[model samples]
Each structure stands twice: as C-alpha cells, then as structure tokens.
Target: MSLSIRNQIAGTVTDVATGGAMGSVKVSVEGGELTAAITKDAVEALGLASGTSVVALIKSTEISLAAA
Candidate 1:
C-alpha cells in the first residue's frame, strides 16, 4: 500500500486490549515498545493479535517541547 506517512516503525504486536468502543495495541520495536489507541472495530478489522508483525504509522500535526 502507498501512504504519505513516512514515520513508520516496524514492530511485532505484543498485546491487544479492548474495552467498550476503544482499544489499545502494544508493539515491540527495536529498543522499546509503543502503544497506540484505536477503535475496537479497527482492532478486529485489521486482525491484530500477539506476534503479529506490523508497521506503526505516525502522523502528528502538533509537537510539544519542554525546557530541560
């Protein structure tokens, strides 16, 4: 598939938690893990599960910075 998003991270799904109409997906990446919130319907539609290999696509319009 073609996408305009470039910040993609390849990882393996570690867990999927669904509640109500929302869902949380955890994926193991190179040095750490990442979690994404998605719709429960999307969780099933994409067939996401543990050990599933997928790419995490990120497209954010805002950036936050804090003084160190």
Candidate 2:
C-alpha cells in the first residue's frame, strides 16, 4: 500500500486493549513502544493481536518530546 505518511515503523504488536468504543494498540518499535488509540471497528478490521507484525504509520503536525 502507498501512504503519504513518512514515519512508518515496522514493529510487532505487544498488546491490545479494547473497551467501550475505542481500542489501544501497542507496538514494539526500534527504540521503544508506540501506542495508538483507534476505533474498535478499525482494530477488528486490522485483526490486530499480540505478536502480529505490522507497520505503524504516524502522521502528525506536532510532536512533543520529554526528557526521561
């Protein structure tokens, strides 16, 4: 698939938490883990689960970084 988003990270799904009408998906990226909140329907359509390999497409206008 072709996407305009340039921040695509290949990773493995670490966890999936679904409740209400939203779902939180965690992907283990190169440096750390990336969590995305998406609709439950989208989650089901993607068939996301732990250990599933996927590409995380990140498209944002602003990003905040913190020192840990």
Candidate 3:
C-alpha cells in the first residue's frame, strides 16, 4: 500500500469552538512555533481533538514558511 505523507508540523490543539455552522481548530506548531486555524468540520472529519496527535501539512505552492 502506498502511504500519502504530508509535510506536517506536529503541534497541540490550542482551542476549539463553534463558528456559525462550522467549527474551528487552533493548533500550536513547533512548541507554539506556529499557529494555524482550521475548520472544525475538517477537524472532526480528521478526528482531531485537544492534545490529539496531528500533522500540519506545509504547502509550499500556496503558502510560504520562514525560519524563526
């Protein structure tokens, strides 16, 4: 089986709440190195949770990254 590996920055779920009809996922990457806000539905679909193990995909084409 071929496994799809995404370039992810591992972090913790900082917060979670409702956004109108959708939800929100705030993850702190790299020891609070980076924070990203994702949709709650996507979080639920991905089975994400507070203190849950997650992968933050680093999309090169769409977004850029920097060294801090």
Candidate 4:
C-alpha cells in the first residue's frame, strides 16, 4: 500500500494492551519503543500481537526533540 506519510519506522511489536474500545500497541525500535493508540477493531483486523512486525507511519505537524 502507498502512504503519504514519510516518517516510517520498522519495528517489532513488543506489547498490545486493549481495553474498552481502544488499544495501545508498543513497538520496539532501534533505541526505544514507540506506542500507538488505535481502535480495538483495527488491532484485531491487523492481527497485531507480540513479536509481530509492523511499520509505524507518523504524520504530524509538530514534533519536539530533547536530549536525555
């Protein structure tokens, strides 16, 4: 599939937490992990689970960077 979002990162699914009508997916990237909140239905549709490989597409107007 084609996407307009250019910030894409490949990662492995580390965890999936579902409650109510929403779900949170944690993906382990190079140095840290990225978490995405999505619908539970979407999670089921994508068959997301621990160890699953996924590409995270980020489309945002503003981003903040800080040194840790």
Which numbered prediction scores highest in lDDT against the true structure?
Answer: 4
In the predicted model 3, the residue pairs found to clash are 23-40
lDDT of 4 by residue, 1-68 (tens): 88878788999999999998999999999999999999999999999999999998888554567898
How well does candidate 2 score on lDDT at residue 51? 95
Number of backbone clashes in candidate 1? 0
How many collisions per candidate?
A: 0, 0, 1, 0
Best by TM-score: 4
Q: Is candidate 2 or candidate 4 better by lDDT?
A: 4
RMSD after Cα superposition, model 1? 1.7
Higher-scoring candidate on TM-score, 2 or 3:
2
C-alpha lDDT of candidate 1 relative to the true structure? 0.92
After TM-score superposition, the amount by which residue 32's alpha carbon in candidate 3 deviates from its true location, in angstroms, is: 2.2
Write down the lDDT that model 2 would get: 0.90
RMSD of each: 1.7, 2.1, 3.5, 1.9
lDDT of 1 at 67: 100
Estimated TM-score per prediction?
A: 0.85, 0.84, 0.57, 0.86
Model 2 C-alpha lDDT per residue in residues 1-68, reported as the tens digit of each score:
78878778899999999998999999999999999899999889999999999988877654567798
lDDT (CA) per prediction: 0.92, 0.90, 0.67, 0.93
* Span of ten consecutive residues with least summed lDDT in model 2: 57-66
Ranking by lDDT: 4, 1, 2, 3
**Span of ten consecutive residues with least summed lDDT in model 1:** 57-66
- Residues 1-68 of candidate 3: C-alpha lDDT, one tens digit per residue: 53354466778776667665576667777656445566657767877667876767666565776898
